[model samples]
Target chain A: MADSTKKKITVLMVGNPNVGKSALFNRMTGANAMVSNYPGTTVDFTSGTLIEGRQEYEIIDVPGTYSLEPRDAAEEVAVRMIRDHPDAVVMIVFDATKIDRGLYIALEVMEQGMLCIVAVNMMDTAHDKKISVDTADLQKVLGVPVVATTATSGEGIRELAEQIRKAQVADLDKIIKRLNGEIPDKKSVGGCGGCGGC
Target chain B: MQKKLLELEFGERGVVREIRTSVHDLNCMGIRVDRELKMVTKQPIKGPVVVLLGEMQIAIGLDLAAQIIVDVIGKDA
Candidate 1:
């Protein structure tokens, strides 16, 4: 009965492969880390806890995937996890160098109507490539919190935690209305139909 | 005659005729129908083949490569 009343917040960290998601997970969770297989799959995911003041958050490092379209077993697991956990906070760790490609997944995630945050990882490398992103402009565009981060060096992590604390459930109706006609039908976008062999 | 992209020899050039797999995936990588490409390299056994499309070098898996049919009109014509 006591456990039923306790509020346990869950946060999911998702991104493309090699986007520093595991590194960020380690930094955020420190020594309190545990690994468990995703429900009904062989793929295992890491989970840990982050405590701020009196509140505690459970953070899971979701398997890296290019899109939520379930192209493979890993991607299937990722898409299912996101779909099952509607109340979890979705944090997308994006490679700043390939923001355009990352946005593809971002659009899919936002359409799910979960509370979301964008962590633009690898900012240091983006700087090396002479690519600059205006975070304020990005925040205005996505209508959510956007934090620039370099997970390797622990930059912007504190700000990310603060934002996570403030994260709220996404306004699905408002977002869907604002992005009307933007989201493509699942069968048309990224579906295998070039030669009908799928 | 139409030949699979996997069958092209290194340094051989061909024009993409049809994609048997997901066209959206190819489009994401900047590949398109009628695009000219040159086989740059192919890994040992059944690995990905590297092709030069314009100024960009793309590596595609052998399974997907087989689905990309190209017509070899001539040698680097």
Candidate 2:
């Protein structure tokens, strides 16, 4: 068996475009930053070192894409980066106002069976629109910790970071099978109230 | 009459009548068929078109806008 203790922990930031992925990255990493192209790809990605408690995490800001499906060059880079680091903690930043679309991508990521956390960004806008989302309800549906946040104001970001540190791999085997059309069960499909997400 | 969203001039009003592609892409911006839209911005030559929908603003690529069919509302005709 390989030594798991030697493995380095990485936190990958991902979300749809304009969902404040970069803002969140800046908040988490502070100053020391490196903006570089992904190895052989022309697409650029930002990375920085973030220390949480006793552990140091290599946080990477991935390019935003609507879905894991590569519709363009930037999307290809994002998908490849996520696939390359299967062990990295995936932080999915989503817009609270556009939860349906965000949830669709969230399901796709979870289908890959990676450790994930759902950060419901733009909470301020959601509040202004009178749209209320219960993170606990979402957590129960996604089988992961869901944190509400307003990246611009830094609201709930501390709780998000703490949850990120405590993130774990979700049990998505059954859901993956269902999404892939290998099963016929629809009970869990509406658990999140038809928002296309939980 | 029905026309592509790309054809709608700035400040032009219309109702999104159809989306030729998957609704998933448009859903992110809260766009759906029958929603009232206003052309807020359209850059010269190949650029994204900004559309105002209620309180939300969505910037859509020209290529994608071509696939979105809208019925002219003629608010500022």
Candidate 3:
């Protein structure tokens, strides 16, 4: 069943809202992605093909999510993408200007047992705001590859592609256990946590 | 091609441009559009406002277009 010839890589882009995830998707796939202020515009998954190192890859852009737990239907899809597609490389796109919030999601993604790559998107904006993020420090903390990029202006897009070529397929059974067991019971999340009002 | 994209993204009639302020002061200020610049105002246009593409079907009239342009861009509209 394995072609064994052409290596098809699927890069899943996941992160918090307003980090220019769709913008980076457009730059990678050369597809003009639709952008908006409000979150959840990208509900379903989107895939595009890019030729890299004589191999074709199906780059995936999953919906924006905040945590490992399925906070809602969208997070369920995001977690499902990680569970169902273990072979895909997970690219955690975080806002350089606001790395604290995105970093939280990055930690949750790491818990999913995927070989993750952290890309700090919107460096230009961060720089303009006089905000600077130590990408090296982030990688150390996250235990993954960290890349700085200004996705809007096409900066650091090529490095992202080249890195995708070197992405490794993570094991699956291990991921499944985490999805089911690793998620903390909502009952312990305190009262009025939103979901089910329990 | 720019106009076509503007038409496609904004709508057939939705044409807006970014209007630069004259005083060049204040933390936030509203302005209008510059058809020549091919940009629009999105309110508090100060700071690093991300210029993004809006969905089609949301079309604005010429008067509103001039208002948006002049409101954010400048009186040149």
- TM-score of every model? 0.67, 0.67, 0.58
Candidate 3 Cα outliers beyond 4 Å, as residue runs: A1-4, A167-198, B1-77
Q: Over the full model, what C-alpha lDDT does candidate 2 score relative to the true structure?
A: 0.77
Q: Which ten residues in a row have the lowest lDDT in candidate 1 chain A?
A: A189-198
- Positional deviation of A188 in candidate 1, in angstroms? 37
- The 10 consecutive residues of candidate 3 chain B with the worst lDDT sum are B23-32
TM-score of 2: 0.67
Candidate 2 per-residue lDDT, tens place, B1-77, comes to 88999999878999999999878668655678888989999987898999987756788998899999999988664
Give the range of the ten consecutive residues with the poorest summed lDDT in model 2 chain A: A33-42
**Which tens-of-lDDT digit does each residue in A25-120 have in candidate 2?**
777778433323222222457888666665677888888887887778888889999999999999998888878667877877888888888899
On residues A44-118, what C-alpha lDDT tens digit does candidate 1 reach at each position?
477888876556888888887777776678777788789888899999888787676567677668888788888
Better by DockQ, candidate 3 or 2: 2
lDDT of 2 at B46: 95
lDDT of 2 at A174: 47
Off by over 4 Å in 2: A1-6, A32-43, A128-131, A165-198, B1-18, B21-49, B53-55, B61-63, B70-77
Task: Kindly provide the TM-score of model 3 when superposed on the true structure, using C-alpha atoms.
Answer: 0.58
Residue A85 shift from truth in candidate 3, angstroms: 0.6
How accurate locally is residue A28 in candidate 1, as Cα lDDT from 0 to 100? 85
lDDT, candidate 3, at A101: 60
Q: List the residue pairs that clash in candidate 1.
A: none
TM-score of candidate 1 on Cα atoms, chains taken together: 0.67
Docking quality tier of model 2: acceptable
